[model samples]
Target: MRKISVQNLKGGTGKSTTVVNLGAALALKGKRVLLIDTDSQAHVGMHLGIKHSVTLFDLMTIDLSIEEAIINARENLDCIVSDKKVAVLETMLVQMPRREEILRLRARRLKNLKYDYVLVDCSPSISLMHQNALLFADYLLIPVSMDVLSLAGASSIMDSSRMLLQMYEMPLQIMGVLPTIYDGRLNMSKEVVSILETNYKKLTSVLTPIRTDVKLKEAAAAHQTIFEYDPKSRGAEDYMRLADELLELETRLDRQKQKPAEATLTA
Candidate 1:
């Protein structure tokens, strides 16, 4: 029962794309998954072919549990949707205290659900909505494009992320920086990758670049996932590899927990 947020301070870093495909990929591995779209654009629900006008506004500001807002995308894929109207939550809940805890409260019910993962898509801008996303997250997965603005954006976001965690006293771990839409053949791309590794030494292999594949845009336009559109495509392969890395991390965490319990028994 872990919550993961995919966020970036700047736009066009493929944060939403990584979160969406990763959810689908994990489900393909038989993990029952939920994707919470905290973005105002609300493209995630559309990607799953859902036209329901009901959105996160209904769940966040009004009366609705996480389960009540969840829409079934497939046998294993579920989504808690949002829409442009979600931007109204700030004004809607401005008078209330603990407004940022909206996501945390809703997600608490998921503790008992038989879910393997909950992947959250955070809005690009820094808003209370993004705060909700962070408050509920166990870890943050930041997607940084190999571009000047996107790289610098990570530092700005680290400041904001730190502030939010400090407010809540959260001990959130950075899953890693995910580099997307990169073309290694270009000198700029290679140079940026080198700078990224040098600047962000904590980045895991999960930080490897995902090539700028045409299939990604095409699939997004069609409201389909890379796996559904072209499983053999480089973009699809990259996402699958990312998913595998996440699975390995989950396994490692489980072992880390068991080790303390084993040590206690030996003592």
Candidate 2:
């Protein structure tokens, strides 16, 4: 399964929104998607209208199996929800051995499952939980809004990822930098996109931006996904395109991985 963590150091950059909508879009295309919410705010559950007694905290602090913590939120989408209780883990993790690897070790069980994608919605804080998300994920998906603060958040994540790579030798790759809430009519929005493309294009892809849409906020307020709220809306269309783009990128990566083995055999 492809494990991706959607994170930004600043709040309101659409991290949870991207995770929920993108996961839903992929699920609508018949992919089995699992979303893990690591944020104390628990926006993922709110967006999906899924309430659960057992959450990520239970899975980590207790002996609860990962499978048991999972809630089937939609036809092809499942979720491991989180709540305010998850905040305590930051302090609790300090005393635990291999704290950074906790999530990764626990996630190994997912290999036995049939999920096609695992998307983690991470907290905006720099804590043990944040480190765990980075260490657990194979790829990092950053969502930057049309603002300087959001861009700074994206840069912070990139720097942190580089540090983790050098320190732990983890093979985490940048999936892409996604521009969320983009308004083409606004010069500010255009400028932000340009800056992102200019700065990050060489390191990773600057994906198709998700246009500004009131329907997205409405969908969240209604406790539904864009696809579920209004399939014909611009938000829905953008997320669908994102799903396709991500799938294509993953396919290309897989083919690239195979080329080295193919060369070895020929040699």
Candidate 3:
């Protein structure tokens, strides 16, 4: 499965929104998607209108199986929900051995599960839970709101990911930097987009920005994804495009990986 963690060090950058909508978009495209919510706020479940007694906390602290913790949130989409109880895991993880690898190790159970994508919704803070999410993911998807502080927070996430790579030698790649809540009428938004494209385009992909839409907030408030709430809305369209971009990028990367082996055989 393609494992991705949607993360940002700043709140209100649309991390949970991106995770829920993007996952829903992919699921609508006939892909089996699993969303893991690591945030204490538990926005993913709330967005999907799924309430569960068992959560990520149960999976880590107790002997809850992955299957038992997973709840079917929508057609072709399943979720491992989280709640305020997850906040205690930050302190609890400190005394655990290989705390950074806890999520990764537990996620190994998913190898036999047939999922096309596993998307993790991360909290907006630097903690053991954040490290676990980073270590467990194969790719990091950053959502940056149209603001200077959000841009800086995205940079900090990249720096921390680099540090983790050096420390653990894990092959975590940048899926893309997504600009969220973009408004073309606002000069600040335009400037932020320009800066993002100029600085990050060459380093990593600067995906098509998600346009500002009130429908997105309404969807969340209504306990549904953008696709479910307003399929024709700009928010829904943006997320659909994001799903397509991610699939194309993964396919290209797979082909690039195969080329080396193909050349080896040819030689």
Off by over 4 Å in 1: 203-206, 252-267
Q: Which portions of model 3 show Cα errors greater than 4 Å? A: 255-267
Tens-digit lDDT string for candidate 2 (1-267): 999999899889999999999999999999999999999999999999998999998887887678888999999999999999999988888999998888888778898998999999998877888888888887889999999999999988878766775588645477899999999999999999999989988666799999999999999999999998999999999999999999989875676456633311110
Q: For model 3, what is the error of residue 188's alpha carbon versus the real structure, in angstroms, after optimal superposition?
A: 1.2
Instruction: Give the whole-model CA lDDT for all candidates, comma-separated.
Output: 0.79, 0.89, 0.88
Clash pairs for candidate 2: none
Query: Which segments of candidate 2 are over 4 A away from where they belong?
Result: 255-267
Candidate 1 minimal-lDDT segment of 10 residues = 258-267
Full candidate order by lDDT, most accurate first? 2, 3, 1
lDDT per residue for candidate 3 within 22-136, as digits (tens), equals 9999999999999999999999999889998889999888866789899999999999999999999988999999998888888898978999999999988888888988888
Residue 122 error, candidate 2, Å: 0.8
